[model samples]
Target chain A: MRFVLALLATLLVGTALGLAATRWTASNRQGFSAEQAGPWIAWPKAGTSEAEPYARAFQARTGYVPLGGGDGVALFALSDSDGRPLEGNCAYDVGGAVPAARFWTLEAFSPRGRPVAGPLGRLGFTSAEVMHDAAGHFMVAVSPQVRPGNWLQVATPGRFVLVLRLYETVLSASAFSLEADALPAITRGACR
Target chain B: MIFALPFFLGAVLIAVMVHLASLLALPGFATNDAYARLGRNAPIDQVAALTQAQIAALDLPFYDRSFETAVCKYDLSAGVLRLRAPSPDTMLLVTLIARGGNVYFSVSDRAAIKGLVEVLVGTDAQIEQIEASDKDDEVLGELRVRAPKPQGVALIRVFAPDETSKARAAEEAAQASCQIETL
Candidate 1:
C-alpha cells in the first residue's frame, strides 16, 4: 500500500510538471499566422468570386490567359506545350521543375474540393513516387483503366478538381505559365 | 498556529518563483526571428504581402504552435484565410483587400472578443482600439476595425470562429459588409 501511494504521488507530480513545461514552451511561439501553412496560389474555381480578381492579376502580369471558368464546376488545366489534353476520365499529367528539396503533387478532388472518390479516393504524386524517363523527365497518369506507365486510376465519372503543389521549386524552372505554349496535351484511348 | 503560518508563506513563495521562472524561460523557447519581423507597428498590408510571399515560397508549415493546452496544429485546408498569433493566442479569419484609405474585416464570434482586449494587448503593441459594433449576429461576430498607425506598414486584422470562416472570407473578400472597403 505504501509503494502504491508513492507511485501515485510520483505520477501526479510528473504530470503537473509536464503540463507546466508544455504551456511554457507553447507560450513562446509568437509570430506565425495560420494561412501561411497551406498552398498559397489557387487556380480559378468556377462560380467563385475570387476567380476574376486572380485572372485579372494573372493577365496584368502575363499577356495571355487560359480557358474555362464560370460555375458548372471548376476545371483547372495543365496541358503540354503542343495543345495536348492533360486531364481525362482516367488520369492527369503533372509537370514542373524541382530542386533537390522541391517536389510536386497532383491530387484530384470532387467539384466541392473534397476528395470523395477514386481507387484510393485520393492519389498523391510526389517526386519519390515516379518512374523518371531517360532524360530525367517524369510523367504520371490518373484514370480508372490500366496504363503502361505511372498511373493513378479514377473509378467513376464525376466533377473533379486537380491540386498541383510544387514544393521547394527552382525559381526559373517552376513553370506555372498558363499560356497555350506552356501546357501539356491530353492523351487517352476511347472507352467502350 | 505559528508553524502553519510559516508553511503557508513558504508555499506562496514557491508558487511565485515558479511563475517568474516560467515567464523568463517561455519567451526564449516561444519566439524566433519570424515573430520579430511581424511587430505591432508593421502595416497590415505589409503583413498580408509578407504572408503571400511566404505562402508562395512554401516556408509556411501546416501545423501551428499549440493552442490552449493542445499541441495539435490548426487545419488550414478546412478554410481560406487563417491567422495565428502566439503569446496572447489570437486566431482570426480576416479578409484583406486594399480600397479607399483603410482595410476591413468581418470577425467570427463577438463573444470571443470578451477576451480579445487582453489577448491582443498581451501579444501586439500595434493595436490601438477594438470596438464591438451594436449590430452583430448572435452566432457570427461583427466589428469595424481602424488601424491608422502600425510599426511599419498598415494592415487590417480579422478574427474568425474557425478555419471555415477564414476560407470563406478569402473567397468572398469583395463583398461589402458592416465593414466596407473604401478608397
Candidate 2:
C-alpha cells in the first residue's frame, strides 16, 4: 500500500509539473529578444533552427510564419516608448524616419493576433499609402478614435500590439542591432 | 525521516524529468501550429492562395497586409516538391518552413535569372539522386534545397505597394505553382 501511494504521488506531481512547464514555456517563448529599439523587440533568429525551443513552440502556437533572414525583418512593440503597456484607451503617435528599406508596413493587432476593429475600416498602413509630410517624413496616428492624418484604428478600452515589417531590406541580418534613433518613435499622446 | 527524504527526492526527480519532457514535446503535440493549420486548409503538393478572410481567421501574428501570400504543404517522402513563380517587378520571396516553423531556405526575386524563380525541395538523399542522374548543369541550375523534414510548408510572398496593386499581386501569387515531381 505504501509503494502504491508513492507511485501515485509521483505520477500526480509529475503531471502537475508537466502542465505548469508547458504553460510557462508557451507564455515566455517571446523572451528571446535579439535586439531592442526603444520598446520594439526584434527576434532575428526566430524562424531559424538556432531559435530557442520556447520560440519554436511559440511560433507553432501562434501560427506566425516569420520572414526569412534574406527576405525581411519584423519588429514587435507591446509597449510605448516609456515602457508602459500600450492600452487602447490611450492615443499614440508613431513617427520618424525609418531605416533604408524597399518597403515597410505597420499594423495593429490584439493580444490574440487579430487586427483590432475600429471605425476606419482599416487596420494598417503601408509605406506607399501613408501620408507623408513636405520633409518626406511620415507619422502614423494610432488610436481608437479617428485622426485626421495617417491613422491606424485600434480597439478601444483594451491592449494592442504593433508589428512593423520591413520587406526586402538590409536590416535582416547585420542590422539587427539598430539604435533606437534609427527607428521610429512611438510616443503616447492622450488617454481617456 | 531518512526513508521519507528518499521518497521526496525521487518524486522531485520525476517531476523535473516530466517538466523537461513536456517542454520538448509541446511543439510536436501542438495541433494548431502554422504548418498543421496550413496543411489542414490546403492539399499537399499544391499552392493555395490565402484570402484576406482566411488570413484573418488564422490569426497569425505579424501577417503583413501589404503582401499577398500563398502556401503549399509539401511531403518529400512521396516525392520532390517543385515550386515555380514569376519574378515580380517589386519583390517576390519564397521560403521553405519546416514542421516546427523554422525557415530552412529562402530566395528573393532578385536572385531569379530569366524572370523565373524555380526551387526543388527534397531530402538530402533525394537531392543527391537527382544530382547524380542529371549530368547537364543547365537542368540543375534551378535552386535545390534539402528540407530537414519530410513534411512542411512552402510560402510565397508577393509585394503590393498599395491597395490598388493588391489584386494584381494576389493574381500573381495565384499563378505560382507547387507540384509533386516523382524522381
Candidate 3:
C-alpha cells in the first residue's frame, strides 16, 4: 500500500514539475537563442527552421509573427539602457548607429503590440527620413510632447516596447556575434 | 513529506521526459499559433495585407509596427500554389512558413529575375505532377520550392523607410497575389 502511494506521489510530482518548467520556458526561453545589444534583444533564430524546440514552442504559444525570415532581424527593448522598465510617461532618447543594413525602421508599441500613434498619426520613423547631427549621428526623441529633430511620438500610456528592425543587413548572417555598439541605445530623459 | 531517494530520482527522469515531450507536442496543440491566428482573417489562397488595427487585434507579441505585411494561407492538399508579387523596388521579402510557424524558405526581391517575383510551391508528388503537366519550361522562370507540408502560409513584407515611401510600400504589399491551380 505504501509503495502504491509513493508511486502516485512520484507521478504527481513529476507531472507538476515538468509542466511548470515548460510554462516557465515558454515565457523565458530567449536565454539560449537571444543575443543582446545594450537594452535590445534579438532572437536570431525566431522564425527560421534552425530555431530550437523551446523557441518553436514559445512562438506557437505567443503567435508572434516574426519580421519574416530573409534579409532582416528585429530587436526589441522593454527597458532603458540603464535597465529601467520603460514607462509611457517617461521620455527617452534613441541615439547611435545601427548596423549597416540596406534599410531599417524604428517604432514604439504598447506592451500589447499595438502601435502607439499620437493624435497627429505619428508612430514611427524610417531610416531614410530620420534626421542626423552634423557629425552624422542619428538621434530619435521618444516623447509625448512635441520635440525637435526626429521624434518617435509615444501616445499611449503604461508599459511600451521599442522595436528596431534592420533589414538587408550582415547581422542576419552573424547575429550570434553582434557587437554591443552595432545598435543604438535608449537613454531616459524626463517622466511626465 | 518523506520520500525515498529512488523515487526522487525516478521523478526527475520522468520530469525530463515530460518537458521534452511537451516541447515537441505543444505546437500541435497550440490553439493560438500563427497559422490559427492568420487563418482567422486570411482566407485560403488570397493575399491580404495586415492592417495595423487588425494586427493589434491579433495581439501578437513583439510584432514590428513599421513594416507593411501581407499574408496568404495556402492548402496544397487541393492543388499547387503559384505566388507572385511585384519587386519593382529593392526592399521586398517573401517567406514561406509551414503550419507550425517554421520558415522553410525565404527569398528577397534581389532574386526577382524579371521584376516580377514568382514562385511555385507544392509537395514532392505535386511538383512531379506539375512538371509533367506544364510540358515546357514555363515554371522555370521563377523559384520552385517543394514544401514539406500540405498546408502553410506565405508572408510578403515591404519596407518603407520614410513617409514618402509608406504609401508606396502599402501599395506594393497589397499587390501580392496567390493562386492555386489543380494542375
Candidate 4:
C-alpha cells in the first residue's frame, strides 16, 4: 500500500509539472517584445480584422501594401525556420501545423511587412501550393539562394518578415501558435 | 491510506494540467470569438462569397485561428444592418461602412485610431480631423473625424458600409492603382 501511494504521488507530481510547464512556456514565449525579438513579430492590432490595420498603416507609411486582395486579405507572422528570432540575409526553412481550412499560405516579407521583391516571385508564397517536410510539416525555404523546398530568396540583404496566413481561419478548428521562441530560427550561411 | 495519497496527488496533477492548457487556449479563443463576431454584424455577402476569389487571387489562407461564421442583425425600426466582429465590443465594421463616408468617426483611444482609419477608408490615408461632437445622440468609436465634401463642408449624416459603399471604395482603390504614375 505504501508503494502504491508513492507511485501515485509520483505520477501526480509529474502530471502537475507538465501542466505548469505548458503555461510557463506560453508566458515565456510572449515575454519578448518586437524590439527585443528583432522586430519580426506582429500581433493583431485593434480592428474588426487581424493584420488589416497593421498592413494598412504600413502601406500608408511606406507606400507599399501587402499582396493578395481585400477579400482574401492574408495575415502573416514572421519567424525563423528553427524557431528563433529572424536575422537578415540568413537561410531559413519555414513550416507549421495548419488545421483543416479552406486555404492557407506562407509568404516572405521585408522587416517592414512588405513582400520582398525577388526573382523567386513576389517576395512571398501563397497557398496555391506549398512543399512539406518528411514529418508532414508545411515547409518553405527562405534565403538568397534558389534551392529546393519552399524557397523565399532575398536578392538584397536586409531584415525580413514572414506572413503565415489562414484567409478564412474563421471557419476552421485550428488556431495559430505564434510566439517569439516558438518561431523557427534560421541563420543562413552568409549571416552565420 | 497510502493509495489514497497517490490518488489525491494524481488529481492535483490533472487539475494543474487542465488549468495550464486552458490558459494557453483561452485568450486565443476569446480573440477568435471577437474576430468572428465582428465580421458577423455585416452582411455575410460582404465576406463569405470571396472565399474562393480571395484564396486564389489574393493568396489568402483560411488559417486555423477559430471558427468562422457570419452574424447579422436587422434593425426593424432604423431599417439598417448591424454586423461586426467582437473586438471593441461595441459597433461593428459594417456599422462604420454602412454609416457612409460623410460620417464622423469618433474614438477615444488614440491607439485604436490608426486601425479604425484603415477599416473606414480602405486606403490608409492620413486622418485630418480632431474635434468633439456637441450632439449627445452620436456614436462612440476610436476617433471621430467628419468627412468633407469637395467644398470642405462637414456632412451631418453618416451611413455605414453598405454593399454599394464597399463596392465604391473598392472601385476607387482599383482606379487609383491603375492611375499611379511610373517613374
Candidate 5:
C-alpha cells in the first residue's frame, strides 16, 4: 500500500511539473541574445537549421518569420538605452548612424506584436522615407503626442517593443564584431 | 515529519525529471504553431496567394507591408514539392520553415538563373529516388533541398517597395507555383 501511494504521488507531481515547465519555457525563451547592439538584441542564428530549441519555440509562438543571414537581419529592443522598459506614456529621441544597409525600417509594436496605431495612421519610418540632417544622420521621435520629422507614434498606453530591420546588409558577415554604439541610441525624454 | 520528508524529496526528484523530459518533448508536441497558421489557407502540396485580409487575420509578428507573400504547406511523406517563381524586379525571397518555425533554408533572387528560381524539396529517401529517376544533367543541376521535417511551410516573398508597386508585387507572388511531384 505504501509503495503504491508513493508511485501515485510521484506520477501526479511529475505530470504537473511537466506541463508547467513546458509553458514556462515556451513563454520565456529569448533564443540567442549574445549579440547586443545598444538596447537592441540580435539573434545571429535565429532562422538557421541549427537554431536552438528555445529559439525555434519562440519563433513558433510569435509567428515572426526570421530572414536568414544572407537575406537580412532583424534586431529587437524592449528597453531604452538607460535600460528602462520602453513605456508608451513617455517620449523618446532615437538617433544615430546605423551600419550600412541597402534598406532599413524602424517600427513600434505593442507587446502583442501588432503595430501601435496612432492618429496619423503612421506605424513606422523607413530609410527611404525618413528625413536626414546635413551630416546624413537620421533622427526619429517616438511618442503618443504629435512630433515633427520622422515620427513613429506609439499610441499604446503600456510597454512597447521597437524592431529594426536592415535589409541586404553586409553586417551579417561579422555580426559578433558589431559595436553597440554603431546602432541608434534611444534616450528617454519627458513623460506625461 | 521524518516519514513525510522522504516522500517530499521523492516527489521533488520525480518533478525535476518530468520537467526535463517535458522541455525536451515540447517542440515535438507543439502544433497550431506559426507554420500551421500560415499553412491554414494553403492546401497541402499546393501554393496559395495570401490575401491582405488573410494576412491581417494571421497577425504575424513583424510582417512588412512592403512585401507580398505566398505560402505552401508541404508534406514530404506524400511526395517531393517543386517550387518555382520568376525573379521579381526588386527582390524575391523564398524560405522553408519547419513545423517548429525554424527556417531550414532560404534563397533569394540573386541566385536565380535567367530570372527563374526553381527548387525541389523532399525527404532524404525521396531525394535519392529523384536522383535515380532523373538522368538529364540540366534537370539535375537545379537546386534540391532536403527537408528536415516531414511537414513544413514554403514561403515566397516579393518586395513592392511602395504602394504603386503593391499590385504588381502581389501579381508576381501569385505567379509562383508549388506542386507535388510523384517519383
Candidate 6:
C-alpha cells in the first residue's frame, strides 16, 4: 500500500509539472523566433517550417493565423512606450514612419485578442483612408472621444493592444530590429 | 513512512521526462489551433468573403478591419487543389497552412504571371506525377507547391485603403476561384 501511494503521488506530481511547464513556457517565452522592437512584438518565423516548438504551441493554443513571408510581418503592442499595459480608459497618440512596406494597417484588440469596439464601427485605420500631414507624415489618435484627424475611437472598458501589420514589407533579417524611433511611438495621454 | 532517497530521485526524473515530452507534443494535440478554428468559417474547395460579423465571431483573432479577407479549405483526397486569382488591382496575398496550422507557403500578386496568379497544391507524390506527365518544353502557368500533409487551408487577404475600395476588394476576393481537379 505504501508503494502504491508513492507511485500515485509520483504520477500526479509529474503530470501537473509537465502541464504547468508547457503553459508557462508557451505564454512567457521571448523565444528565438520572436522579435521585439520597443513595445511591438512579432514572430517572424510564424507560419513557416522553421518556427520553434514554443511559437507553434502558442499559435496552436491561441488559433492565430499569422501572416506568411510573402504577405509581410505583423507586430502587436500590449503596452505604451512607458511599458504600462494599454487600458481603454487611457488615450494614446501613435505616430511615426513605419518600416518600408507596400501596405499597412493599424488596429486595436482586447487583452483576450478580440477587436476593440468603437463608435460608428470605426475599429481601426487603413493606410488609404488616413490623412497625411505635410511631408507625408502620419499620426493617429486612439481615444474615447473623436478627434478631428485620423482617429480610431476605442472605448472598451479593459486593457487593449495595438496591432500593426506591414504587408509586403522589405525588412530583411538584419533590418527587423527596427529602432523605436523608426516605427510609431505610442505615447500615453490623460486617462479617464 | 520513511522517505527513501532513491524513490525521490526516481520521481524527479519521471517528472522531468514528462515535462519535456508534453512540451514537444502540445502542438500536435492542441484543439484550438488556427486550422481547426477555420472549420465552418469557409466552405471546402471554394472561397468566400468573411464579413465583419463573421470574422468578429470567429476564434481567429487580431483580424484587420481595414482589409477584406476570405478563406478556403482543401482536401487533396478529393483531388489536386487549384487556386486561381487575378492579379489584384492593388495588393493581394494568399497564405497556405497545413492541417496542424503550420504555414507551409505564401504568395502575393507580385508573383503573378500575365495578370493571373495560380497555384496548384498537392502532396509530393501527386506533384511528381503531375510534373512527370507534363510534356517537355510546354509551359505550365500555375505555381506548384507541395503540401507537407494531405489537408490544409488557404487564407486570402486583400488590402483596401477606403470603404469604397474595401467593397470592391471584397467582391474580387469572393470571386477568386478554388477548384479541385482529377488526378
Per-residue CA lDDT of model 6 for A1-192, tens digit only, reads 988888788778777777787787765552456677889888777756777777777776777777776678888899998899998998899988888888788998886678776857877786777778886668999988877788888979888989998888886433466567778889999998
lDDT of 5 by residue, A90-124 (tens): 99988888878777878888766788868787667
Task: For model 3, state the Cα shift of residue A32 in Å.
Answer: 1.7
Candidate 1 local lDDT, B1-183, one digit each (tens): 663454445545554555445534432332221222232223322223223333223221211111111111111122211232121223322322111111112222222444431111110222221223323545432232332222111122322223334444332322212211111
Q: Which RMSD does model 1 reach against the true structure?
A: 20.9
The 10-residue segment of model 1 chain A with minimum total lDDT is A65-74
- Scoring the B chain of model 2 against the true B chain gives a TM-score of 0.86
Greater DockQ among 3 and 6 belongs to 3
Residue ranges of candidate 4 with Cα displaced over 4 Å: A1-42, A49-85, A133-135, A170-192, B1-183
DockQ of 2: 0.62
Number of clashing pairs per prediction, in order = 39, 0, 0, 59, 0, 0
lDDT of 3 at A2: 93
Off by over 4 Å in 6: A1-4, A24-32, A172-175, B1-16
What are the per-residue Cα lDDT tens digits for candidate 4 across B46-122?
Answer: 33322212313332222211111121212222111112222222111222211111111222112234333222221
Provide the TM-score for each candidate, comma-separated. Answer: 0.32, 0.91, 0.88, 0.36, 0.89, 0.91
Residue pairs clashing in model 2 are none
Error of 6 at A7 (Å): 3.4
Candidate 1: where are CA atoms >4 Å away? A1-75, A78-101, A170-184, B1-183
Fnat of model 3, as a fraction: 0.72
Give the Å shift of residue B62 in candidate 1. 15
- Residue A95 accuracy (lDDT) in model 1: 44
Candidate 2 residue-wise lDDT, B1-183, digit = tens: 775776677767777887777767777776777787767789888899998788767767767767788988888888899899998867898988888666778788887879989998889999999888876745454798999889899888898877788898988888899888888
Cα-based lDDT at residue A173, candidate 5: 28
